[model samples]
Target: MIDRADFLARFGGVFEHSPFIAERALDVGAVALPLTAAGVHAALVAVFRKASEAEQLGVLRAHPDLAGRLAIAGELTEDSRNEQAGAGLDRLSPAEHARFTELNTAYTEKFGFPFIIAVKGLTKDDILAAFEARIGNTATAEFETAKTQVERIALLRLTAALPGE
Candidate 1:
C-alpha cells in the first residue's frame, strides 16, 4: 500500500489549493495500492463529485483567476504557474492583460467562480476566446462547466505528476 503521507504529498495539490480532496479520498478508502494516474484521478474526482455543492464551490473559488492578480503578483501555486506559463499567459500584452482582467471580473460576477480552462495546450488567444464564449452561459450551466474544467485540470495534474498513465 502507498503510504498516506506520500500519496497526499504527491497528489494534494492536484485540485489546485484543495488538498482536502486528497485527505477525504484517503479517509473514505478511495485510494488503493499500485496507484496509476488514472486510478488516482478517478479516486480524487469521485471524492470531489461527492462533495456538497457548497464544498464544490469552495474548491472552484480556490483557483486563481487566469492572468489576474495572482498570476501577475507571482502568487499562483507551482502547478498553476507552470500551466499558465506554458499557455503563454505569462506573456500577455497590456491590452490583453486588461481584457483578461475585465473578462475575469465579468465571468466571476456572473458565475460566482473564476473562469477555468485547462491551459496546458491552449494559447492565450484560445483561452481568451473560451473565456469570452463561456461568459454568456447561464449560471447553472457555467457552474457545471467550471466543475468539469476543474476535473480536467486535476486529471492533467495527475498525468503530469504520475507520467505514463
Candidate 2:
C-alpha cells in the first residue's frame, strides 16, 4: 500500500534485526501494494525459506537468548524486550535466572545455537520446558526447529507492527 521505502522502515526489524528479507520481498515484488501484515509475513517467510543455510543460521543467531545476556544488560531490542518481559523473563528470581543460564549454556553447547522459542504469551516455565526438551534434538533437526521458531517470532512482531494480524 505504502511506498517501498516506508514499508521497509516499518517492517525492517520484523525478522529480528534483519531487513534483507523485507527488501528482497519488495525487490522481487513478492509483496505488492495494499500491504497487509499477513501478506508481508508470507512474503518474508518465502524469502527465509530460500535463504542459504549460513544466512538462515545468521538470522537465528541474531536473536537474543531469553533472559540471557542481552536481557540482563538491558540491550535487547524493544520488541525483544517487550516479548521477554511479557513472558516474565525480565523478572526472574536468582534461582530461576541461574537455571535459565545453565540451560542456555547447555543448549547452545549442544546445538551450536541459542535456545529459541516464540515467547509471546508463554510463561517462563513454558520456555524452560521447551529449552530442556529441545536441547536433545539432533543438530540438523534443531536447526530446522530454530528456523521455525524464528518465523513464529517474526510473525508475532509483524502482527504487532503492521495493521492486522
Which window of 10 residues has the lowest lDDT sum in candidate 1? Answer: 156-165
- Residue-level lDDT for 61 in candidate 2: 82
lDDT of 1 by residue, 1-165 (tens): 778898889989899788999999999999887788898989999999999999999999999999999988899999999999999999999999999999999998888889999998999999999999999899999999999999999988888777445
* Candidate 1 collision pairs: none
Clashes in predicted model 1: 0
Query: Of the candidates shown, which would achieve the greatest TM-score relative to the real structure?
Result: 1
lDDT of 2 by residue, 54-152 (tens): 888888888888899999899999999999999999999999999999998898888777888999888999988888888888999999999999999
- TM-score versus the correct structure, for each prediction: 0.97, 0.95
> How many backbone clashes does every candidate have?
0, 2
How well does candidate 2 match the true structure, expressed as C-alpha RMSD?
1.3
Q: Specify the poorest-scoring 10-residue window by lDDT in model 2.
A: 156-165
Model 2 earns a TM-score of 0.95
Question: Which candidate has the highest lDDT of all?
Answer: 1
